[model samples]
Target: MPASDSDAPARAPWWTKAVVYQVYPRSFADSDGDGVGDLGGIRSKLDYLADLGVDAVWLSPVYPSPQHDNGYDISDYQEIEPVFGSLAEFDLLLAEAHERGIKIVMDLVVNHTSDEHAWFQESRSSLTNPKRDWYWWRKPQADGSAPNGWGSAFSGPAWTLDDTTGEYYLHLFAKQQPDLNWENPEVRQAVYSMMNWWLDRGVDGFRMDVINFIAKRVELVDGPAAATGGGSPMGPQIHDFLQEMHREVFEGRRGEHLTVGEMPGVSTDDALLFTDPARHEVDMIFQFEHVGLDQGEHKFDVLPRNLPALKQSLSRWQDGLAATGWNSLYLNNHDQPRLVSRFGNDTTYRYESATLWALVLHLHRGTPYIYQGEEIGMTNVRFDFIHDYRDLESLNHYREAVEDFDLDPGTVLAGVQTMGRDNARTPMQWDASPQAGFTTGTPWLAVNPNSADINVAADLSTERSIFRFYQSLIELRHESEVVALGDFALLEPDHEALYAFTRTLGDETLLVVANASDAPLSGPLPADVSGAELVLANYPADPDAAAHPTETTLRPWEARLYRL
Candidate 1:
């Protein structure tokens, strides 16, 4: 195992102090003229990421797959997909990333595998195959229906019938990806072997997909439907399998490897259990509470809620996890919409609004993660037809809205238009060239229409661009101990327009303030803080802006960071 100095502070553990940049490989860049992103394309972008000051890059899944879930469904763990590159190219990318002081974390989809996977193919060949138990299969009901009434995450019943076997298999997501039977000891051992194999190849760590879903309700009892879609409750026995996974794959034998779990549908208290360092289940976990703030109950309705309520939830999670375990903090990801269009005024004040939103989340208590093109303030695409959508989740939701709910296609498209996974999957805007230079031929997904005006090459040269603001933000956190590991205290919780917080480590203090409203209000700084020095701001205070205290108003969606 690789070793660092034992005396190094735990706060400065390899991952906590490291800034992570998420690269959705398909959209990031294309180098081989294959019209699809490859490992070589990622290698070409290493210098750009390093210059942006991120210490690590977490690439979305690149393993062999049918692209059922945009590579989230894996057919083989040990080899790179033919379209992405060869295994040798993956090794080259890893080496190049390390040369730039950036660690690479592979996405590990352990909860399931692609139906085309060799293991799943073997399991489904017959009712009495050697690997029959490798996946969850249940006997059909007397009525020949699925054993339970659970709903798939994408939509409709969670079970898919295997006519050949005369049984049903569980699929939380698309039917093409079957849930693995983690209860099988052989399955657990196989997962562990894969982990070791990747680590042996010098991959830094793993961003575990649906880590908490590995466990399940062994009884397979029916659950009450959700209030809206009447979906099934989360699987049972999730924690039991998590503990086993920790012992075998994550902790007992691995040395200082980072593992962040996508433990959706977890409560703050439940999240505490999965991330407790002593439990060894994960280094940290990404909570989706903030991401779903504007979402309606089981839907995306665009109904605005009180900002304080959203702030309160974030505060609770931040304070709750501050000392107990770590946090994988982010505002956008490949599975979510772009933050600029969804959360901020992306059209009118793209730069300030986007940077303000970034400051509010990135400078918090957890380790910050930046998604591809987020630094450049990417906005959501406006598609005209249902055929425009590519994500499986969006397609299912649209179908459900039109056929099951009897809703008009326009309204359903509007809902998905405003909030959908495809927003984040658009080909990255690298330059003003055709298709934003994301591909030489046609892109796998359409590029944003505004790409010509919002590409990275343009932002890199502009001093006041959102990309530069993020670059500055990254530098501030890395250079300041208080921002990285100090105790966090959210101040002025009731202030409607002011989002303020302090990070103090002994005598050093850092203050983060965001003007969340179109107009600004002022209050005295936190009672304990004095003589604050302006560090970074989306809109810097001019002499006149700095002179007035109570009257010092901020422009719409302004944000600032200070040191004391």
Candidate 2:
């Protein structure tokens, strides 16, 4: 470990104050001319992460796959995909990262596997095959309809009929990715074995993908007429399966490993059960209550931002898990759009709003994750053509909406431009070069047109860079106990333009105030903040207000942190 690991006094779990950076490998960096990011590219960026002060790197899947879901549909669990390099390179990346005092957390996607996987192939090869029971295989009704009214998350029916076998297999996602039958003990053991194999290779933890969806309704109940698709992700046996997985994969290695489940429909009540230490399910959960606020009935149906509801949702999680469970605070990842563009103002007050958002999230009581390109204030992409998108979800939606349902192309394009996954997957901007210094060869996806202004090189050269603000936030979390483990109180929870909160630990208290809108905001102080010292201020202190720097009044997109 690096000398800075022990800089702070002892704490129980190492991750509470630690920040984890998420790397969507394919868009992070490209070492070879293949125009795709690989393990070697990640190895070259270790120093940059070390300087940024993140304690861990949560990598999206790099396993052998057909790239149908961009590496989510794994065909082989034990080896790396050829485009992303080999197992030897993966091992080297792990060794090099640990040398810089950074832990590696691999994405664990056990809920499903590619149709080309050996198990799936054998399962579908014959109805009476030994591995036939490894997947959900159901017979059609008398009229030759699907098992039920269930629909696939990608578009149509969840059951894709195998022409040769004459039986339908359940695929909650793209037909190429089939959901595994966890009811089979063999399947559970296989997943456990694969996880242990990775652990032995020195991985620090896992970011489980849709982990709650592994256990589904065994009865296969019929769905509503509308067919809301993908069935209930939080099944009846979710807790039982999670406990069994913990015992098999991380029982004795407890505090040494971190497990964060990405559960979409999880409630605060259910999150408590998943993250409570006594339950042995996981270390934390990535809940979607806050992120889903801006989306309409459909994920791509973008809507205007709602600040009050966002405050209520996040505050509930902070207070709900206050005593027993933990939280994972993140605004962007491989599957979500850029944070600044989605929630914060990205055009006029780009730098100010970006830093303000960081201040509000990092001060909360959770383990924060910084997605790739986020430190440099990256924005969503605006592609002129629909064919330029590479995300499976976006492409599928556009096709179904236009060709089949006869929807207007302009409306559909507008939705995806505001709320698309590809907006977050563009190649990382390294410099102001024509290619943004991401690759010498053409990129797998088009670079953002505004990359020249938002690249890492320009941000680092500026005095008031978002990168420097993020670096300070990480340092504060590592050094201040109040910011990490203190009791949280959301003040002015219903305020329209002002977001206020406080963290108290023993005799020390930390206050955070932010103006989330573009206009100036004035409000009464939540506490006496009169004598508090201004620890952080994004805007220069006005000469007249210098004598009283802790005032609750703020400029457009201004955020201030005070300590008393």
Candidate 3:
């Protein structure tokens, strides 16, 4: 039987209440005019982050890498990327961040390693090499083609033939990033050892990348004859691998540390097992279901987002995991487009929509994540030409769609504009200076053209800036126990543009309503908010409205919270 709300476990660890800020290291800040952000750059901005009231900073991968997939293709697990900083700089950043009561969570990309990594290098040396089993390598089929029909996420076949070994290796992502063979005990041990080394250095936790793909199906069969490409995300051994990782790396050090796995194509049931405290797998998992709502089979093929579908998807996860597990709430990240541009209005109603989105996400019974530029209501970039995009996946897909598939270039460009990951990877807009104050040198990627008006420096002093609104939301989560542990109930789930929900803990209940549209909405209270005390709102609502609450008018993208 499904567990009742009363049977739910105790309030989660500190992380459950904590607001995590994800910093894309390469674009967050640049200190040395190197056109790239580094550890010192992040350290320099510690005061800004602390002022924003986030509990932890989740840094995207900064490990040594060839950077084929940014820093996800790690070449050395134990060392910091030279472009980012050295080991000493990392330690300094950690120490300084902790001094200000901020925890640091490193990105752990263990699903694969760069081909330049020593293990992969040795693995490809010869079939008889000692480290041959460190990565997934298979002999070519009789037709001299790939070992399987699996596809690469970046386009084309997932298998890349290694001339030195005369065999094909699996890479679910880019060809340069060869998937690790977690079936081999030594590979798992190496990953754990690297994690331990970082933990011993005072890093608080890890945000594991594509962790679900660690264990692929043993049979390595073809996905579907009609499939474009990409191997199965979930494998039979995923649970075993995660359990082993917990026992070996996180068993005794579980307390005070966060472990969130980024699992693509993961179902709610699989997420429960992965996050169940008794199972000891992970503290939480980042599921892609919500983000993929408007995305077609291919991410570039955009579709209209349905409000009911989104509410149903999120509500199911909230109810499914209420008894034992936790959720990580977010709308934007390194691999996704900016939330305001994708889901909310980014023009005249930018601030209103951004804050409304924040209210909706943070008020949910889960830990909220704020992407680097999200607090300031950053919009997606408008790069006129494809060359302006630096994302490998975006570039490859654009080429595949236009050149191979013979699709219209204009159509492909429009899709790329709407869904490209590069939209979120533009340089951080610190000020209105040249290059948006990111660096004196030319930025690796173009700074958003609108940064002159929409930037941190300009918003810092604005009374109703999106940044200040996000700060208030974070403060609320920290102050209200009900916000942290309340049982969630979706209100008006069928409403096309109104997203309304309530959180109940003991006798205290909080109602949150947002008009997730560009037009004004007026309606009767979705629930009994008769005696609700006005707690928060993105726009100034008449104080008398709360006294006699028969009906309310929500401004464009307006959001409100009331305590009952």
Candidate 4:
């Protein structure tokens, strides 16, 4: 059991202290020996999630898709993909998860639809089709070039010429995912109808995918020369559309649901507006500032992590949203590499570093999210060859770097190895079985080769395992209001390797310190932490040592929490 702290105030919103666990449906579990996980597999694992103490499960998109960009490219909004299961199975999973006190938050992907969608099919039938204006279509330039210089997020131009229609259409991502024309009132109504349908079917909330890109600039002009053919991250009418969405779908049902928009390039100032309760735009926004700390111009161009810069980014968010808005804290997700592999020492100090990262993220004043397998300290997978990689983004970038730019294939492969989405898409390591206990047949994607050693089964019975540490942290959040609603203050802003901060509420103050690197660190305790109670630590503390020690020594990647 985790320790409880009674000295704090209650937070009104149900999600303030909630911990969300993200489950990428295809990779989570496979119950039917079909090599792919389905709703039944998730239903079978409800007990595990309940025992893990998460408040909700944010499932990645399981809608009917063509699998071009995994499940993000949806062909049908109302039906579940056959590979995942039917609507009946989804209902059963929802019921089972709710029975375990876990809310189900569906992944809402409306930024674009798969080219096979009925609307897109009709839109492309002819230039004069009523549905034609539902998508962006433009005549080619006089020189037979694209309408604009916008680039596709996948690699090439955003505009693709249609031979039959004799015009080009816009697709910000893969050509198969054509962006919807949000300026159309009918489109907005249709989207809201879909959202209301899901909510009526018992989904607790939505984790909207790339929702900010739904509203593009009216003129649809070319972006900067180096811009990744995806147009503006934020457009002039984004807020208007969001506000209208709130009025249409969430006006009277505010507190009954949660809405988090995945805004890739949102800054703190814009986040404040997006999350302001009075505005009703969204409950929260997942900003990318901190996650991009170790990347250069492009995501594949990896850079050394800078602790001070990271601290500044996170601290600014904490301070900026301290009053009006809220935040969603996370390290790993379906789109990013595993946290332990990217931010922590996944080899020599895997357990310690995982625990340290969890402590820092959970102690902050925000709702924390844990990606599947992260609790067990999953590391990035290294596919020996390009043939093993399955993510479209990785494969596209690899082709552009090696074939188009003439970059060294080995160097490009190394970058993909370090920062590919496939690293997080590998099947969950359930046990030391031939398929990591995820399936009886071959997995849709290769299970990480190291699953035999780093798996949930091996860690479940271990008292000091990373899974256990995460469980304790989640329990603490449920029991301690200070962990959820307390004010945040950075303690060592300039510390190169140690991330330390304080959380205070009324008469209660908590200090959290973590050694983010693989070296021992000794430092003088923060000014007011002298007599604080040693509430938690990755490594067991010396019971005989003085509680008010002036200085502290942290072992490699160690973390400690003190309550004053």
Task: Judge candidate 1 at residue 454 and give its lDDT.
Answer: 92
TM-score of each: 0.94, 0.96, 0.96, 0.96
lDDT of 2 by residue, 167-202 (tens): 888888899999998989999999999999999889
**What TM-score would you give candidate 4 relative to the actual structure?**
0.96
Q: What lDDT tens digits, residue by residue, belong to model 1 across residues 1-564?
A: 001222224436666667899999888888877678778888888888988999888989999999988899999988999999999999899898889888899999989999999999999999899899999898877788777777888888888999788899988889999999887889988998898888889998899898777877654543332112232234556666767766766565545577888888788887787777777667788878877778875655766745776778888887877667677788889988888887778787888889998888877877899999999999999899989889888898998889989988898898888888899989889999999988888888888899999999888878778888888888877876666677778887877777888777767777887777666555554443234578888875646445553245566888877776
What are the clashing pairs of model 3? Answer: 151-229, 151-230
Stretches off by above 4 angstroms in model 2 are 1-11, 221-231, 547-552
Residue 541's C-alpha lDDT in candidate 2?
A: 71
Report the Cα lDDT for residue 478, model 1: 81
lDDT of 3 by residue, 345-380 (tens): 889898998999999999998899999999999999
User: Candidate 2 clashing pairs?
Assistant: none
Query: Which of the two, 1 or 2, has more lDDT?
Result: 2
